[model samples]
Target: MKLRETLEAQEFEPYIHITRGPGDGGHWARQYAHRFDLVLISGGDGTICEVINGLSGTDKPIAIFPSGTENLFAREMGVLPDCDQLIQTLKWGRRVVMDMGQVNHRKFLLLSGVGFDAHVLLELNKFRTGNITHLTYFWPIWRTLWEYRFPPMTVEADGEIIVENARGLMFVSNISRYAVGLRICEQARYDDGLLDICFYHCTHQFRLVKHAWNTVMRTHCRDSMVTYRQAKKIRVTSTEPIPFETDGDPVGNLPAEFSVIPQAVRVILPP
Candidate 1:
């Protein structure tokens, strides 16, 4: 109510809805889909993902107010935490259309991952609580590294076939940022109309440590053990069922196809 009051004091009319849960906002937003000019999401990544799924086919522009843990997508776009500045940005910012990734007809605002990252998400989901933070992801990530086994998989992207017999994480992204300010896909651009694929193909602990170091230094993609490619479509299939996650929410297991919808959704951005 305070945020709404602040916006109203500035003479901007904002539609506010208090949803029952994570998935409820999406459905509620869809109910008012055609009436609102802009959908301003004021929750976490999971809430934004639900809104994205709800507004998938429409041309409505979205402005995010980051109120959730691990606001990777919002931080990448340079969205700050000040409500007054956010209101001003909304009033005067330029509109840009960006690509969204689709998995089995669901929409994801940021990257999607299969195998290792998904397992981490599952662990986090079980352990996470109010105001999830970097440590929430970090602890599980370390645990997953210690106990998790990487499964072999086949990935086909942009006509290049990779059949790997090792365990690691595969990240498919339309944006550059990941958790804790990591630039996992440095070459990725929001409006580039391409999907960036990063595969960690090494199974050894020491090599994985090296990969982590390179990732922190933003040089992982250049390694021989790390495969990076740009494709319009990517098909990932594993020998067994592997969990998959999109935008920090666990969806389901794969055999999955992820395709880019270029310039698909309109977003209000800082001018």
Candidate 2:
């Protein structure tokens, strides 16, 4: 509401949109983006993901309000929560063109997970009621941690076999930072026309926990069980369809092929 007042005070008549359910943000954005100069989004990572999908392949730049839990992309772009900062960003912000990742046909601007983390979201949605916070994930994480099986999978990067029949977690990211500031893809550059994929080879629950700790310490790359690579295209296949989370939503199961779209979107960034 304060954001609305601020825009109104500045003599801008912005159309207000409130999403009613899943994919509404993207639906509205894709349908009405042609009429707008700048698309401003208010919500969390999931909402931002939807908006990005709607505006994919267009020149319409976006500014975020960063109201959601773990607003990872907003933090990566240096967007803040204050209305004053938002006003400054609007008036004198840096304009950046960023790369986006595509899984199948859907687009993502942050990171995608293809293993246990994605499994957590799949379980969370089974009982998700409404808006979620960091705490909302605790139960789901705990449950998925116990139930998840380290499925065997094969990964190909630019048509080269990087991982063959590996059992662990796979992360593909456009940015370095993830939830809780972990640099899962530490060398990722949003404009570099490549996606950074990290595979943590684990066979048991204890190994999974160790991998998580090493990742948080930013030392996972040096671990023998970890594989990190940057590629223009990445493909992962499993004996069974495994669920993958894009941005923060558990969209569907995978046999996913991920490709990077260079300079695919224009974004307003804090200076």
Q: Tell me, by lDDT, which candidate is best.
A: 2
Runs with alpha carbons beyond 4 Å of true place in candidate 1: none
> Model 1: per-residue lDDT, tens digit, 1-271?
7789888888878778887876798898677877987888888778887887788778888988888867877887888667876777788987889998888887787999888889888988886776677666788888888877677788888666865555677899988988777888878888899989889986756677888899998888888888888988888888788899988878899888888989888888776
Evaluate residue 231 in candidate 1 and report its C-alpha lDDT on the 0 to 100 scale.
Answer: 89
Q: Which 10 consecutive positions of candidate 2 have the poorest summed lDDT? A: 245-254
Could you tell me which residue pairs clash in candidate 1?
A: 150-167
Global lDDT of each candidate = 0.83, 0.89
Residues 1-271, model 2: lDDT tens digits: 7878999998778999999988899999989988988999998888988888899867899988898878888888888888888888888889999999999988898989998889998888898997887788899999988888889899999999999998988899999988877888888989999999999998889998898899888899999999999999999999987889988878788699999989988889776
> Which candidate has the top score in TM-score?
2
> How close to the true structure is residue 76 of candidate 2, measured as C-alpha lDDT?
83
Please provide TM-scores, in order, for all candidate models, with all chains considered together.
0.94, 0.96
lDDT score, candidate 1, position 260: 92
Candidate 2 error regions (>4 Å): none
